[model samples]
Target chain A: MLEKNKLYTIWVYLQAEPLFWLTLTIGAFLVGDYLYKKSKLNPLVNPVAISILLVASILIATGISYERYFNGAKFIHFMLGPATVALAIPIYKQIHLIKKETTSIFISLIAGSLFAIFSTYFFAKLMKLDIEIIYSMMPRSVTAPIAMGISELIGGVPSLTAIITILTGIVGASFGTFALDILRVKDMTARGFAFGLASHGIGTARAMSRNETAGIFAALALGLSGVATSIIIPLLFKLINF
Target chain B: MLKSIFIIFLFQLIGESIQKYFELTIPGPVIGLILLLISLILTKSTKNIFITKTKEEITTTSNFIIGYLSLLFVPIGVGVVMHLSYLENNYIEVLGVIFFSTVLTIGFTALLMEIINNQFKKHARKK
Candidate 1:
């Protein structure tokens, strides 16, 4: 009984330890990465998904509130801002390859960004989904960080925005090439741009695996469309008053 | 690497300040991105040795940060999973909407892009 009591004390101490939760977050990712490799790098076996599940399960089992867990994990979350700003470096590197097509590229991407926003908006409304869900679905065509920000501003549930954004990435990555093939759009650059603009990082990953040109264009679209969507959605919201 | 990171943070700070004052709807980091891009462009041909060293550091540090980006989202990803029940009723609708819109957006962008590029090339030839 004395040994059991000592063990409980250690567990309680660890629960509140910021380093413990931080280590657990990283440790969960390591385990998730191992499983991802074991699964042959399958898309559905997403490391982020697996790690989120692992930590969420542990949190639930331990009955720890998310606020406490986040207290420890906030260090990791805080990097997102610096990392997002760092995005400009890569986009700058790719500037020369895209210099000639800059005009066309920018126009196509803006069209795609607006299309992504409004198409989801109208479809969700047509289905009679809740307005919050509609707003959530609207910004999901971008990456999670940007999408969640838009979700917050436009009255969407940020959590739902994150989940649905991942769904869009998975869907676009899985079927993006097939859909493009069907559309007779054989230009790899265009296809890559479509993948990034519509699906965000996951589709960008898929495009990267295909070839170099496709990968570059995919990356270009990912950052530019994110920036464009950020400006466009709010402006549109102000205009539409919804 | 540390200096590169500080530079990134510096731009983010500038961005946050400007965004707050202007009441911009854009994310501060995104605004920082534009500022960084413009700065990189402005310094593209500079002869300053210090600027040269900083540029290389920025590249490697930013790439390192980007490589582990998915790891950083783990917390929010976990938060979203907890709230899955809130979206449970609209799963089909959400999935359906995502599929069609993604497919449509891809097709529209690809087709229109090709057409615009071809037209641009022909116009250049005519000129």
Candidate 2:
């Protein structure tokens, strides 16, 4: 029975190894992405959220602590910084489109960013969420990395902000089109800017898939709105003493 | 691909340095983003190695990174489990707030943008 014992030993070793969790992280992402594709890229089947559930459930099932999981998963997390830096390329490419509608694009961007912040704040307040939860929720309208960063600065749990941000993205991507249609917004640019500003990357992805002009404007606003929110939310919090 | 990765990471490092040096509140990656955007704008004419990357090279690398951007967030997103205690009692309200705010934000932004664009068009016609 040495062979059986060897298998058990290997399993035990795998559990302790950081690479196991890393592999799980990538594998889970693949599975999630596959399902997202199968769903025809349904916004509800968000790859990131699915991957998160897959990993979190596995972690809980295995009784492995988050710290241990993070020990392995941090490699993927580390890529976030560089990926964020890479947003400049898309933003740069979209700059040409912005030149024609500069006034309209800039105005909607500021208005949307402000609405994202204040609406979240007042709604969370109305819902009686904790101050910390409110803080984490403030940047939910922006991309995940910057949202997490903003959450950290505001003394909120960055991790929670990540989840909240993902949830917000799914919500935006899923309902955004329907909402825009209801508003009778025919302009692709407006529709795109709305998705990018309110929904962040997920909405931008949806916008891109649906229409080219919408996609371009969506991407442009995705970067601009993130920059806008990152600068505004923290200072706004201090002024509101929140 | 390796070169692309290097350029992206290099910009990120430069971004971090500038943020740290200036004691900037903005994240370094973001600063890196702005700097890279500026660099791309200025270096439309590339001549040498350090700044030699053509737009195609930088765009290829950045696009590669952006392609897998969502995957990078998976690790941190899963950390939401630790906050399970907070949600145990009030998940509905929290989710309600999130959904409502998101819907409101999207609705208002789209509506406002449509109105503003119409106004701009009207002003242009007047001109």
Candidate 3:
């Protein structure tokens, strides 16, 4: 057995640095992503889910606080902006198709945004949920960064928005294709638009794997949905006094 | 490889500049995308770029990045750790809102698209 003095020294050193937590989070995520891909369960195997599990396990076992982990993990968070920017390349490729379907895309985005906002508010009221939780849930379908920002603006917890966003992605990835088929969405544009509006990036990924045309429309819808939701949700909230 | 990297950076730079100068609500990458689309349209007479070796390279690169895209959220997940108090307080409301809104959004968007597509088809038939 190790001596008590030596064990205490090691524990103190480990607790002092942020890199220890950062490495664990990223390493676990990469491993989880690889294993999930290899397992062939489904492309819907959300890496975010696996990463959350891994981190939660580590936190519980090691008695490390979340604040310590975030101290170093913030670097990875910075990449989200660049990644979103990179999405432009794919969207640029489908500009012509986007131009042709612009009207329909606009209409769908408006309808979708309204539905996302009102339905959540309505359901929260029915369920007797608190006002803050309703505010956080309002931006669940939007991308995480934007959702987090919106959550803050609406007096909800940004962290709750993040969790809600992940759940939305998982649900979108799992049910999106089936829903499309059940609804008999035959047109490639409509299918892509539906996926993007509903699931955001995960749904867009599903669309990209199917066909180029679908991929293009998915990108357009994803970008447009973000813009439309950002504008419409805020305005609607004010108008509705929620 | 070098050319693709250069083009991406150039577009990103242009996008960032536009966003900074104009205070547009649209993100920089989006503006860069519009620029690229304009360029592509103007050069439509040129041969398609996706036919050659470059297509293979791009597809491979994009696939690799897309595969791990979800992993990039770990940091954000970690950030959520800081918000546990808020989550504990608002869990029910949050879950309820997300579930109902997602279902409604999907249903409404799909219906709207169906209507628009039907209208377009009807117009085409009339023409």
Candidate 4:
């Protein structure tokens, strides 16, 4: 009975600790990455998306709450802040490219950012989504942290905005290549900026993996659009009395 | 690795402080990033030997971190699970808007930029 009880205690301890879920998150990501590579880097089969599915399902199967899973995972979350600051490295390296194309880049940033905001708002209303949902979706194109702040300021739910922003990123990263090709977007800078502006970090990741120039431009635009949208979206809303 | 990471954290700290001081909605890390970039550029142009060496260190460390950037996002990405109930309740509209809008936004931005860039090239050639 003592030996049998020892096995049960070990299982309970595994369920209760952060280390198990942390390992599980990393393991799931490795599996997802392997599958992504095996699939020839198919965008549709995104590693992050796959890992999320695997980890979430495992949590569900084990009857673990999302809160507890996050407790183990928050260490990784904390790193995103520093990583964001580190983006300056790539942007600095590509400063020349940014300076050379300042005119077109600024134009593209304004047009694309406005298009993203207005289209999302119009469509959400067209779909008859709740007003709160509309507000949450407004900043979906921005980086996660910035988007969450924008959502809160607009009286939307921050958590919902975060999920929507991530979903937008995954969608953009996954389908971006195909869309760029279909649109005949030949300029690497344009391609990179588009993905970065619309999809933020994940899209930047995809761009970086494709080529160096693409990654640099993506980083530039990712940072630019975040700053631009943070200021512009709020002003636009206030001006319209929204 | 430790030094590079510390440098990044220091920038992030400075960024956060400025953000709070100005009551800006923009994140501190981003502002810190721009400050870092400007400082790096200034240091590079001045050709400071010590600064150049540190820049190289930052470059190598930043590159390594970039490689794992996606990994850093995994935890937040997984938070999607917490919103499953809300998503389930509005699957069609939510998913539809996300899918179509993402496709449209990417297409429009890329195409518009490409068109503008080609025109600029054409104008430069004419000059």
Candidate 5:
């Protein structure tokens, strides 16, 4: 009986330790990665998506607040900055292709950025959602940090914006390839750009898994679209006074 | 691997400095990306010392980083739990807008890019 009590006390202490959630995150990703690999790289088996579902479920079941989980998980989040900077290497490698299509890339960036923002706004408005919801939805297609930044600047809820951005990523990462195929957008560069523009980092990851050229274009589009949207969304919002 | 990581973080730091100095709306890492690209281009053109080896190291290191890029986002994705009630209350609009707008954005962006790309190719051939 004493041993059982000691064990339980240790368990409770461990649960509150940041090391615990950190280990859980890495372990969950390992499992998710294993399943993803076993499934032959199916988009449906996306490791991030699976890991999120697993982590969220565990948090809910254990009654641990999301903040507690993030205490450890934030370490992983910090890596995103470096990872994003690393993307420049891939883009640099594909500079020739990007140079060749600079004009088209610019055009696509503008069109895609505006279309994503407006379509999100229009849809939210049509649904009669609140103005704040529309504002948060406006930056859904950009990466989370930029999206959240833009959402906050535009008077929206950053957490909600982050969630919406994740959902956009899941949707784009899952359905993007199929949609591109149906539309006969067979050029890998175009397909990758579309995916990244609509889904950001997650979509870029999906594209990176497929081909190097696709990954480069996806990164280019992802980086540029974020920059473009950050500048454009704020200006447009201020102009419209929304 | 360590060298590559140092280079990446250095660029990120530089980028953060520039972003803060300029008060730009874009993230620091993105600005770092641009700076890194420009430096890479300069290195390639100027025949700088150790350029080949540096490029090779960066390429190999970045490849590994990019391979598991999606995994880094898992933490943020899990942030969904922080806003469960908001999502639940607005589930209909949330899911519907995400589904419709994401699909529309993807389809529209791809179609437009294809059109523009074809036009560029045709114009380049003429030129």
Candidate 6:
């Protein structure tokens, strides 16, 4: 039989409001994901869009503090590490293809990383953004934890970095295919690599839905871009005096 | 299933130990991933075991988890609420940076990918 203490803990979690929020968020995402899989009107079915709407509506209606929601939502956060690790399984399956395309992957990553960073920096300067804001924006293309760390290192607001990262992911997931078509990017490898490099995990998720090869390349790009950005952003900040 | 979970935890343990001991720039989970990959490659048989065992669990868990991943941002977003004053003060600059950086990152990545695709095709033809 379960102990009294364990029962209490379970009861507390069951009563937690954040759990409800998380459930709603997950439910909405599943609906969106299912719809995307079933229909060709892919843009409207974006899980991120649905999630943002659900959460925003809840927040507006209840006036629930983000912290209150986060208390229950952190269970979902803890899974990110394991989810990232699980990416290795898909990556392992495609190891043979990865080896064959090592050169292209290398070139793609280097070019993609540089272009992502420089263009953000260049455009921020053109727009006359404050130095701190520019620094915060520098790591926007990478995944969240790394982006937050880079923002802190380069004197950008971590909170702002988080917002930008989400926006980047959603936009990437939404318009990524259209962008590829406009550029006439037909190769699966290039499409996947570009998506992952530009959009991180969310982009990789979209890639996985496309094909196995694309998924593998996307995961690799996501991991590599995260690592590279963490190293490069701080150095670039120092060199450029941002 | 239990064994894969054990292996994952063991790898995570090793990763955390390395991080605690050396204080590396990389996160422990990432290091754990690398270590697991290397070990799996070394004992190739375990790769089959690991995949077979965790296949279904990982798929279901990944599906359930991916949707809620965005909620992790809520805390950070709420931080925006707490810092309304700072945001108001720096509103224009903050909004400008977010807008331009996102657009430019997408544009440049797409452009660079096209060039790389063209070069890759050329090299493939030579081969």
Tens digit of lDDT per residue, candidate 1, span B1-127? Answer: 8899899999999999998999765668878988999999999999999999999999999878776766777776677666667787787888899989998988898888878878887999999
- All candidates: DockQ: 0.60, 0.64, 0.39, 0.78, 0.79, 0.32
Worst ten-residue run, lDDT, model 5 chain A? A233-242
Put down candidate 4 lDDT per residue, A146-194, tens digits, no spaces: 9999999888899889899999999999998899888788899999999
- Descending-TM-score candidate ranking: 4, 5, 2, 1, 6, 3
Residue A6 CA error for candidate 4 (Å)? 2.5
Which residue pairs come into collision in candidate 3? none
Q: Which residue pairs overlap in candidate 1's backbone?
A: none
Q: Which candidate gets the maximum lDDT versus the true structure?
A: 5
Poorest stretch of ten by lDDT in candidate 3 chain B:
B51-60
- State the lDDT at A48 in candidate 3: 65
Docking class of 5: medium
Instruction: List candidate 6 segments past 4 Å from native.
Output: A1-19, A38-41, B45-127
- Model 2: reference contacts kept, as a fraction: 0.79
Candidate with better TM-score, 1 vs 3: 1
Tens-digit per-residue lDDT, A11-109, candidate 3: 778766767766787788777667666766354565666777788777768877776767767666655544555565566566676776678887888
Candidate 2 lDDT over A1-242, as tens digits, reads: 99999998998898888789889999998998899889886666777778888999988887888888898789988988887778788777777767868888888889889988888889889989888888888899988878988889889988778878877877787777777777888988888888889988777766765676787677778778888888898778778787
CA displacement after TM-score superposition, residue A18 of candidate 5 (Å): 3.5
Clashes of each: 0, 0, 0, 0, 0, 0
Q: Per-residue alpha-carbon lDDT of model 5 for A120-172, expressed as tens digits?
A: 88889899998888888899999988999999998999988988998899889
> Model 1: which docking level applies?
medium
lDDT of prediction 5 = 0.87
Error of 1 at A206 (Å): 6.0
Question: Regarding lDDT, does 2 or 5 come out ahead?
Answer: 5
**lDDT at A85 for candidate 2?**
79
